[model samples]
Target: MAQFPPVPDTLNYIFCNTPADFHNAVWVLRHHPYLILDCEGHDLGRAGGCVTLVCVGTPLAEHIFLFDVISPHLSRYDIDALLNLFNDRNILKVVWDGRMDYLELWSTYGVSLENVLDLQVAEVVSRGVVRGEGEIQRMKRLQQSYISTQVSDRLGARLDGLHAVIGLQRCWKECGFPAGNGKDPAVVKMHKSIGSRMWVERPLTEQLLQYAAKDILLIGILYAQFSKQGWIPRLPSDYYYLLGQCQRYVSAHREQGKSAAVDAFKPCQIMPLDVLDHPVGPKYRCNACHRYLSLATYETVQGVAPRQASTSEVPRITTLRRPRCRLCQILALRAGFRMDQTYLVT
Candidate 1:
């Protein structure tokens, strides 16, 4: 069996599960100007799961502090101190893909993160996107163009292919960290299988602890390299404002039902005409057939829409609005209609 490589002796791994230990960890972290933050939780994608472990690491000290949030180790004082540290604008908290982390922190401890430098956002900005194309050009299109420009050679050609933890791993390897030998494939496989269940594990194994520790440690290292390269930029105010909007949207969806939430947050785009909006009720103009037909003539097909919130109370219903009429949908299914030639009824 392949064993995971041991953590270097130069780095410190401090596990804090007691009140005193938690306080000491906070004290150590308080002095750091910048810290890389990450949280591990069960069913993290779901809104209900609370954070299990919080890892804070700094590249300068090469120290990682793991706080066991699920255990009875931390008191309210300790929690408050940790929250304060995150809220301090002077002490920047570095995170990657922080939307879920933000939601989890708010849901669990009612803490709002301040002075957050999301590396994912930084990566996007660093790559540089073309602008002023017009409203028709979507964000995805701009990102694709940006990725194409960054591709120079086969080796480091596709930064867009990297994402999440895997992206961080790639950055570390590029920064001269030991690559394949540092992590065992078997251990990585085990981590993936049991990662979502980390919160429920009564006593976390040494392997799991090491896996979690490496996450934030790599973030700190990558941030240092990115900073030195001058890839990090001062983000615009609008960026943070949009993030706040998403945070509020997620929070509201968790409270009010999904349907109610969508109704409240109407998206900014061309509104589709419902069956009732048709001059002849329950009738639609089919782009494929180029004929007005009754509602019964068309089948309701799935369309591009906002994502529904995951909740038991909500019926997981999708909004019935669609771009193409039923006859067009049926023709497409039969492989008889070409979507490129079709036109919206408008």
Candidate 2:
């Protein structure tokens, strides 16, 4: 793909192979100003693995640019030279779930991850896909999408559902990936005709690569989906601004003593264990949290370890009323004692 004509600020691609080529891509990338990274690599071992393929583009408008490059399956040290380029530099991308991606980059190449955005984080943060909508919905949705249906109509099976989103999502960190699952018999049949290919073995199918590229850009699409009314932008600048705003909101919300309500009443330590296995009658100790009956009741274990503080809803301490001492009560009862004055109680 080439630079999108409509949006000049939108980047096209950053293709690199050799260290020189990597440097070149960095050069080309600087001119474009904005880029989205989609990496592909081989499975060598737990640590010294993953060689990148072409880097793609997602313009804010709707065009894509692709850069084609290859890695000769070099040693980890050699790969480190190239990986350093990814270090600390702000780049836009939506890693499906980037925890392992972050770890792998650090573990293998010592790449300092800076402004990379995990789409999975965005997905969970925005809750874009919805709870328990599950893989089947994505498959069904992909089946109907322009990408999915076009592949299906052209090749007799909607390969994007099987290859890009569903198939590739399964590759979470093993070899290196975001992550996915299988579907029903009909769904199974639909995928069989599509067939899965090892991108490592050969250049990925143009369709697969396109689908993969598009899937990466889908974060931008979804971000736009939300940003129409001040939701969020898929780009790094917007995300940083949003992060700052969220931090302020959280600080103010915190100052309002929102989390201070967790200190109302504490259970006696001995009480939870006493009811141990009993499930009937006064079934108080939630087998889960081991802390009296709370919403965080752990069923099989104390699940509320790190999570105990927030879920406990510590109450804010406001005004304290003093209990009346014998003298204060006595004075109040006297014939001439004024009831209006404040008295110290022991």
Candidate 3:
């Protein structure tokens, strides 16, 4: 019987920590709309979130850039000069597992990772809760190993999709994944990630950038899974609206005296469920209703306090009185606003 190799359960692609590697990544990112990003820090508790290399690019594009920390031999302002080059541009950002990045970057540099789309949330909402490497893809990978061990055990059978099995290949040119899992775990040809997610962050090494770059490039393609045309994905208006809601959510957080308010623009701070233990969660309040809401849930939504009417029609919002604005008094009463709902509206 011919023997096959083992499937890796724990495989981490190490990054290159060199200045030359970083410069190349930056050059590549100047192109492409959607990309994948990630970062690693020393976990210094409310600090230590300095970026090592910021990778950017799309699928099929080569020459990935890697912006690394200035060499010890260079001057102090060298890093600052590189940082200033990427200030405010019309670039779409994506990040996976972003919460820690939110706090760490602030403590390290005044700069926070902002304007990011959360693929982790998308994966959870679309594929259901998955922890660690416990994804259908992971199981499929196990299937390969299972067959190797049980070659005589009814062929064991191999199942693969959503995630791909690759040794060293760019996202653009690799053999894509299949679609679906479960009893319906049939093959659906894919060009990128199974669920189609995006990433945006720094890479650690020259070789690692290749993996990171491919990950983002594939994400850009998979996102189109919901679109009619492969090149143009169908994005709901609410998508952008949700981003605005996040802006308000973060701004409101800042007004509450939480230090990270301005930093709300960071990738990790964009969504609620991503906030496993939100410090601001305890302070969440509904303007229409006095009920306290967990910050984690509140961050996931926008508009006035969420209403839950058992009936068909949504109860109109009531405004509060006693120096309360009509919007709050009239709207508050009809909608049921309380002192908890009342606050200084700027």
Candidate 1 stretches greater than 4 Å from native: 1-11, 129-166, 170-178, 181-184, 234-346
Per-residue lDDT of 250-271 in model 3, one digit per residue for the tens?
2232212213212322222113
> Lowest-lDDT window of 10 residues in candidate 2?
265-274
- Candidate 1 lDDT by residue in tens digits, 1-346: 2122344633458888888878888888887778888888775535345678888887543778888876776678877777778767678778765645666776677777667776654543344332233322333442343223232222131122221122455445645667753444555686578657655586887876777777776676567656665556436664454344323322322321112112312111111122112234555554443445454434343444444467445343332423444323422433434433323222
lDDT of 2 by residue, 1-346 (tens): 1111121222333334456655554555445444455554443112334434534444442434333334564444544544554553554443333333443454445554455544433332332323345555544544543234443354332122121122223222222222221112342353456433244555555444544455445444434444553335557775775443332221211111211113221111111221212222322332112223222111122212232465766554332211222122222323233333331111
Best first by lDDT, ranked: 1, 2, 3
True lDDT of residue 163, candidate 1:
19
Residue 70, model 3: Cα distance from true site in angstroms: 5.8
C-alpha RMSD by candidate, in order: 14.0, 21.3, 16.1
How well does model 3 score by local distance difference test?
0.35
Looking at model 1, the pairs that clash are 299-326
**How does candidate 1 score on lDDT?**
0.54
Q: What is the TM-score of each candidate against the true structure?
A: 0.56, 0.40, 0.40
